[model samples]
Target: MNEKQLEQMKNGKGFIAALDQSGGSTPKALALYGVTEDQYSGEEEMFDLVHDMRTRIITAPAFDSEQIIGAILFEQTMDREIEGLYTADYLYEKKGVVPFLKVDNGLDAEENGVQKMKPIADLEDKLRRANERNIFGTKMRSVIKEPNEEGIKAVVEQQFELGRQIMNAGLVPIIEPEVDINSSNKEKCEEMLKEEILKHLNELNEDDRVMLKLTIPTVANTYTELIEHPNVVRVVALSGGYEIDEANRKLSENNGLIASFSRALTQDLNVNQTDEEFNNKMSATVNSIYQASIT
Candidate 1:
């Protein structure tokens, strides 16, 4: 789960936290975040992490069982074939986990960002098959689209179609607008987000469960724009490589904030640090957000 998903989960009684990456390195880093192999070890370590996180959130005073806890499985484009799809399948098999699949928007592609086709097609096919398999209670969410002016409309249309397919197959669709700090025009960025949400609303039913992803800087500005839209149900906050203090400040300002830390958590844990140092930072970060909602 990314920060936006975490924020959505936080708003409800149940909260979902996603483990960053899959494979050998990911588990070790997750261990630094206070997730021990003892608690989540073996062939089912990935599955165990999902279970443990859910249990912790459910036991927390802030969580409500009436609201469902959503857990997202994120896979980078390169890794999708190896372990990514397998992870999603495992989460779907587990009754308690709500799996959200994430695919990278090909911002790096040179040709109007349309050149990156395989991953998008693979993701769509995965969702289609998951539906065919009757994988109940699992949803699919795309990360924001690429940050390019010419490509924005095309990406939005493509994702909208993806969402429609997912919903038709009995899964929820999470709509995310691409946000890149390098973009020169802030207004253009906002316009792109609004346009995508508007398109989704116009095409889908008003009661559809659609969520939007935004960075902290845009939350205050865009929250009102989305609040009244019946199709929008959740708002997610993307950290965008901001410092912890900056990230926390933005989250505090927003009502529903999801904090995603992939590079930071992975880098910090990979370094040589005492267990105490690891535990302190990990617990502090996780607990601070958990505490923020209650107070």
Candidate 2:
């Protein structure tokens, strides 16, 4: 029997620092933080930057535990040992923050202008690993580009399909279908996205509960219904390349949407800061985001 126990995902009214960048976006993030090719002698040596970045990300929650309730870590950092302590355990035991793992294999180009998350190979193995480690939750992200009703519905359906598997494995799943902010038809796309997501959730039994990480829509308070959905334990927003201030502005317009921001959360921290400076900057940023999440 799978005796792995699941703790309740009590992260409804909270902020999740998103540091789960895959290979394609990691280099750009490193560059923003002043980690450049010059630091490494060769391509094989580049992981050092990622290592340092992960260390900082893991450490930040300790400074502002009240502001961040959870974090979603990349696969590379999920179970990593920092100074002989497991990263997830350190977040929960020391800082009171939950740790979620990013389990998607990344994205693959599909027939439409949109993309799909690559199929998770041997996902059962991954979930078992998370269960063994006592990780709190899991997240998967797929993108929506244009307002094709069929294509958007397909993405939401696939996300929830994977979500059911995650839930059955005893993990809370955050189903993130990120609609591109650059699209000309964003309002139309959001309406379609909302319709399709509700369509699927209505089919699910009462036991099928999940979280949502979405783009901050321009229409004010439109997601109040989604946030209030009984099956939706929480509804969070993604920065999706928006500046942190702008992301906060849109997030504030909706009553219940909080933040699961990746770039926006980490954009301000620099590689050259002293330890004191780094923690101060991180704490300050978290305070700003936390304030936005509640108000």
Candidate 3:
């Protein structure tokens, strides 16, 4: 990513669509879209189908110029280009929507009060490939089901260290510390998450800059300091489990946060709709998300 691309990631209207769920989640999405299972004989085939559909959906005319400034793409889609165009080039080159790749292998089982990201044995290799492909940044996730100080510290520290590695590889990293929305300790967890993130940031050099894709806090606006911090680019918010209206309302309360929503952004679409109907629905959702982002 160049200086201009980096700036696009940091300072856009900041609505990013997350289409990076791993292979395991693809079938569920296909079924929801009413796709037939007879076409694919195995899991790999299923993922291929989903990738083709997802690529087409986002690249359709409806999404081209929406307020969505970036997309977090799964690896399969990233590797497959059309007639010499990177899968995301349609979004980035033509539409100015920067691209980010999901790095972590997903979460391991919870231990010592927090669940950490699954180990990626080839992360350095992966980051190198992503850089070569012109992906603007990377997003990885770790989960916090409850507020445990030791667990929170470990998660934040690990993310920062990995983020440093990513920057060294020449791409920004978006640290995703997600809290279970149903947890009674949501507010406490966010507070601890905030503290640990700040501690790590304070230890980094002045040249370090990264993005955060956090859950919408239980206490809205609690992360304004992060939003305003010099080393932080943009404080992006994940929709977590919130519905569209609720997600929009909660996100609007934060002064500088914007949406990187996945499910919420596509929640109301009817996958069975005709092409014209689908485009109209997709356009409306994009417009709604855009309003929430700018508010």
Candidate 4:
């Protein structure tokens, strides 16, 4: 682990930029960025287009360390370059932003009211390459749709188990067990999630720490204890499906949580915008999320 970036993460006041949308989510992400299905033909070309979008965002002036402390990259992005430097190096060296890699392949089919991550057949090799590429940490995700105790417990256990592997590989893990925003019993799901996370957090050794990326809870300050826990490096909130303004508002109400937004962060940007227009919109996006993070 890079001690400097770790310290920044422990105390940074800005939000994390979740630019890690994968193969499954790339089309929708591109669509919102004003690119349509007809824009790219095959999977390879689709990924190439999305990579171009990511490069544009990363190189924008407003996407700097001042208001965006960290960025999470997809594995493909990690293997790519930006302005003659590897993506992670470009982020930390040129932009002063810490970089993280999204390590999970994708989610499994829903079972027991939740969707766990699929088996990561190459997690070790991936982590090795991530470290070589100057990544500071990693993020992986699973989803919860109901408040079933057994289901939630399984989700948390799977997350922590992978988290330990990430830590042993010398990288912090952002353990995300996202509660579906549209779930019928969302509040109940969050309550159960909190309990499960706390149990695993308590079991960690003194030096073991991890980040949490959760869906913004129904109530303000719902994860206050998690934020204060010694084993938790930071608690970040995902936008789920909330619009930017609504996500920012909910984030501001939560005293210590910060945003790790994907869609909300890029919804205002379009593929056809001029560089000046894109940068201007990025400035506004960064400023709003930064304010909410600090509030």
Candidate 5:
């Protein structure tokens, strides 16, 4: 939907729901949320979720469409394949749906990992298929190396090239500007983002649309920085490694901007928990974001 349409939906009670979970948990969480077997197996399940959510928003006066956004973060180690991501796009196509994709941002050298370019190419091919099948448009998000002056320039150049490839193939690229709350100075982080945005604007053509992600402590703060840059079509507020409720509250107040989340949705779902508990946590997180958007 156009921003005006989205605003209209938000004005009349809409909610954005985001699920921050590993790829392995996504199907189970959808099932726990009352996604029917037929819907789950068929191509329409994604749309069903969006359609059902829209109904809930319209019926609930306290919510708005802008309040609803859905997200999933796939861990690098997870065995879940690329099809899961395409399924997400299918969900996005339904009216009143916005989805964000998150990949792990390695902050420490031990945690840092790389996704091969080949996998990304495969993902693009799947995205093309999803579009051909009339699935929803989902945005892609990733974190590159942290920004030193030279590193930022190189990353921006590489991202611009990648963005061109993605747009050429007809998909939205959501690039995460590296922000290490633990290591990077806040003012320096903000400056890096500003420079990156300027770089993107200089490189992007008039027809190009780019979705950029940033990790910020609050929605209000992120919105203030992002609104200053016209090229930034969406800004996802990072959850700052907090609890889901704290994250949701911040995102609720700043619902107009795109939001990305991680950790909170996945912390409980490791090898230790039962599938049922994992599903519950996932559903709760998704519902929490949905409810927050309405507030």
Candidate 6:
């Protein structure tokens, strides 16, 4: 592991950029960037377009370590090159930001009001590739739609189990069991999810540290205990469909948690914007998120 990168993750002043939209979420992301479905035909072309979008974001003058500490990349993006360097390498060496890779294949159909991650058939190979590319961590997601204790327990267990596998491969894991923000039982479900996560966290050795990405809680500082855990590197909150302003507000209320936002971070950007326009927007976005994270 890169100790310097780990220190930055543990004590950084800014938020993580969730640029890891997969095959399932890529279309929506592109549409938000003003690239409609009709612009790309096949899957290959589709991925290429998305890569271009990511490249534009990474190479932007405002995308350095000033107010952005890390970025999460899709598998395809991890394998691609930017400025004649591997994507992860560019982020770490040139931009002074940590890099993480998204490893889940996607989620299964909902069962017991939860959607567990689909099996990652070759995670070992993927982790090996990530290590080679200088990625410092990994993120996978599962979803909880209700206060079903049984289902929430299963989801948290699955996350920690996969997390251990990633740890064995010498990478930090960001365990994300997202509680559906729109669920009728959103607050109750978050409580249950927290309990389950703590149960599993208590079983780990002190050296077996992990990060967490969760929905912004219904109450401020709901994750204070988790944030203080010795086995937790950091606790971050996902935007979970919140707009940028709302997300920033909620994040500021949580003392120790930071932002790991996707759509909220890129919502103001457009593919056709001039370079100056893009950089200005990025600068504003990064500053807002950084301020919220440090509050």
Q: What ranges in model 5 sit over 4 Å off?
A: 1-66, 70-124, 133-147, 217-225, 248-258, 265-295
Model 3: per-residue Cα lDDT over 206-284, one tens digit each: 9888999999998878998888888898878888889889989888887778889887876665557888887887888
lDDT of each: 0.48, 0.79, 0.82, 0.95, 0.47, 0.93
Per-model TM values vs. the true structure:
0.61, 0.92, 0.95, 0.99, 0.57, 0.99
Single out the weakest 10-residue window by summed lDDT for candidate 5: 109-118
Count backbone clashes in candidate 2.
0
Clashing pairs in 6: none
Q: Name the better of 1 and 6 by TM-score.
A: 6
Model 4 spans > 4 angstroms off: none
lDDT of 2 by residue, 176-283 (tens): 999899989888888888989888889888977788889998697777878888888778889999999998888877887888888888888899988788888787
- List clashing residue pairs in candidate 2: none
* Cα lDDT of model 5 by residue, 191-277, tens digit: 765666676666677766666656553225544555455555565556656677776776677645434555443344333345565
Model 4 worst lDDT run, 10 consecutive residues: 1-10
Please rank every candidate by lDDT, starting with the best: 4, 6, 3, 2, 1, 5
By TM-score, how accurate is candidate 4? 0.99
Model 4 residue pairs with clashes: none
Residue 91 alpha-carbon offset, candidate 2, angstroms: 0.9
Better of 5 and 6 by lDDT: 6
State the lDDT of candidate 4 residue by residue for 1-295, as single tens digits: 8889999999987999999999889999999999999978999999999999999999999999899999999999999999999999999999999999999999999999999999998999999998899899999999999999989999999999999999999999999999999999999999899999999999999999899999999978889999999999999999999999999998999998999999999999999999999999999999999999997
Model 3: lDDT of residue 93 = 78
Runs off by more than 4 Å, candidate 1: 1-16, 20-69, 75-97, 103-119, 128-149, 264-280, 291-295
Candidate 2 weakest ten by summed lDDT:
1-10
Model 5 lDDT, full chain set: 0.47
